[model samples]
Target: MLFKKLYTKSLFRICPKILSISSLRYATAPSSYAETVDLAYSSYESTEDETSVRPPVVILHGLLGSKNNWNSMSKAIHKSTGRKVISIDARNHGDSKHSSQHTYLHMAQDVIKLLKKLEISKVSLLGHSMGGRTAMVLSLLSSDLVSSLIVVDISPAKTSPQIFSMVNLFDAMAAVSLRSGIAMSKARKLADEQLKAVIPDINLRNFLITNLIQTNTGSYSWRVNIPALKENFQQNIASFPSSLKGLQYCGPTLFIGGSLSDYIGKNDLPEIQEYFPLAQLQFVDGAGHWVHSQKPEKFLEIACSFLKDK
Candidate 1:
């Protein structure tokens, strides 16, 4: 819980601009990489590398989230599991390159490319929200490359109508203007005012604003590609592809849902099992959609226990 306490304390250090929230209902496209998306990633190696034998864990963050969001958790996982942990910035998010196309298939391919480029033969994947969908699709397309799949607070099925708050969040972010040379303070103030109407939760607002960065010119800019994401919002919020209907990942899988979150419900199990036949569903008591952040200790226990199983 040390990292959880530290994460909470760091939230108020400086005010920043907001990012998009989870909007989880849409359709998927065919599984083909029309273009290669350059994904950016960071790795955490075990302290005693010579003794480490666990399969590497690759983490994918949610919509509007970057590899940076998983920094603390990645370190913790590596320490506990003795496995190399790699966290990536999906295309158009964080330091990754922007592209005109944004779909689960495309994103899944991006992850595959990164793994291949790193020469990692197999990995255990952990993804949250939109990242969860990407992980599912990737497992279906390349089951050989995935050792285990852990989906956090998201289902393969269509999301509920309430998830559309992300659409409103995106529209609000797009409306904010960050003229060149503006101070970080003023930019954050303006952003807070605009985001307040759409996103009223202080903690959620803090989580989203972490994506805002101060440019070399003193103006604030989002680390995420806002315009591209907004334009391809529908694809980004899509469900696992229907094209993968008959394909099922027989590998060990886990679905961790937040007890207070409706993103993953009882109705979604059939669809989840249809693709992930070995999936085990668990809920984190007293947590919401951001389950890991809300209950880091419990999340870590569940994750490490699952990953360490032989």
Candidate 2:
């Protein structure tokens, strides 16, 4: 399903003129509004078929997650399907270029560019959390490029209300100060200790600490652009963009929800079907929002099954 280009130019909204500035001073809105960044990616080649012309599966990681998080999963998917798997770090996350704009439009465009760079005309997208939303937008706007989609623990509608509380997590992360020469182990422990007041969940803290890196300067720092992510969280992370209202993707799609997660529910079916008429929904029992991590075997089973079918 190689889709023709839906649009040639990035969508841009003109800023209203400032009354006192001039009669009607206006140029195109700043490029930052829809800027695209070169994403960092890791490719896991298929072991079974070096010459298979099948479309590869592209995994998009979630908020605060990097391609590194999916390394094992990528290898597993490739091993299972004998199809190449490529995972990417979205803008402002992981090793991707940092920018002030972290909206779905900008992110989708980034993926489009990355695909073009790799000469991939069609792909299967597997996304988790924030990445799921990005995949949704890309599929909606460019259906031809998507062969199938697997969304993990999220919906196209508004996200869970609990996501808004992430502001405290970002604040807690921002409050930490790792001095130069801090050991990676000590930095993680110290970060965990400092975050205890705001984030009491040990598992959650450990997951977030995965983003922590020991810099060449011998100092520990977060590679993710926290301030940029924080600025876009309340709106971007909490809900899907309205600008994509009328667009729909007609490709095979699967919505995988964790039974214990509120991120996706029956209430979201209508909204999802509106955009993806062929979409299917499945919930992994006993799994939470981070279903893939919490239940790797089930997640992989379901994902591989879906991939095999469509």
Candidate 3:
């Protein structure tokens, strides 16, 4: 129901599928947003008319989140900025194909392949948490592909203690046995109940439970690759690559942090500015790592203002 509500109101009905070791192709493109970029103005009202074609905005969701996480905001952003919006399902999450190797580089390349398949030469990127890191890496690796960037509640430096703490959450989820033949609703309840043993926060459990999907054979399973995530979380996901230290993306970048979240510290500013000298930072009060969802209006206002100039 959580995703259903978001999808009903979202302007985008289809999302790009990312594959590994295979050709990039649309999973199901018929009767969707495949044929037209200029037709995105039906429900969304364009505020500005530009003589030059503006780059499309490609939105990336965080760990354990799908493109639908940003669907609500995508509509508003397209309405405000008058640009095409493309929300993606990163590999191992959502509708994308899963892979054993999940790292920033691998994820960035998946996005690049999708962009190349779509023939998008230049793009504006909006990403959150893990996806934010992917955006930063992509910007640094292919500076010409990215025109502008918006990173929400994440840093380019080493992972914070809060992110490390997520290891326990993943461990707890892995211990849960959805088993076969259980109804999807019952499986969700069981997963939530079991997860509450280690993670007391019902809100967090419910958020994670949205990843549950019913298999074709009347079985329940999580869409995200838990075993792979567990194997690579600490070394790969939790730590930023040192090899990318000296590299930088000089494109216009905006970093938005949540005041209530410890993901971005006061000390990380120098490193961020070093990698992105043209970077700008903004914070929303009473919000956590999911700043865009927590404070949609303010995040949108600030984001739209930044994209307006770019």
- Ranking of all predicted structures according to TM-score, beginning with the best and ending with the worst: 2, 1, 3
Q: Candidate 3's error at 243, in angstroms?
A: 0.3
Order of the predicted models by lDDT, top scorer first: 2, 1, 3
Off by over 4 Å in 1: 1-32, 50-52
What's each prediction's TM-score? 0.85, 0.88, 0.82
lDDT, candidate 1, 1-310, per-residue tens: 2212200011122222121121111122333334668899999984584224557999999999999989999999988888889999998899998987887878888898888888888899999998998898888767788899999989877684667667777777777677777767777777787788878987777777777788787767787777777777765564555555666677888888887888887567767776676677888888889998999999999899998883
- Candidates 1 and 3, the one with greater TM-score: 1
Question: In lDDT terms, how accurate is model 1?
Answer: 0.77
Best by TM-score: 2
After superposition of all CA atoms, the RMSD between model 3 and the true structure is 10.9
Greater-lDDT candidate between 1 and 3? 1
> Residue 199, candidate 2: how far off, in angstroms?
0.6
Give the CA lDDT, 0 to 100, for residue 281 in model 1: 80
Name the TM-score of candidate 2. Answer: 0.88
Q: Judge candidate 3 at residue 269 and give its lDDT.
A: 72
Looking at model 1, report the run of 10 residues with the lowest lDDT sum. Answer: 3-12
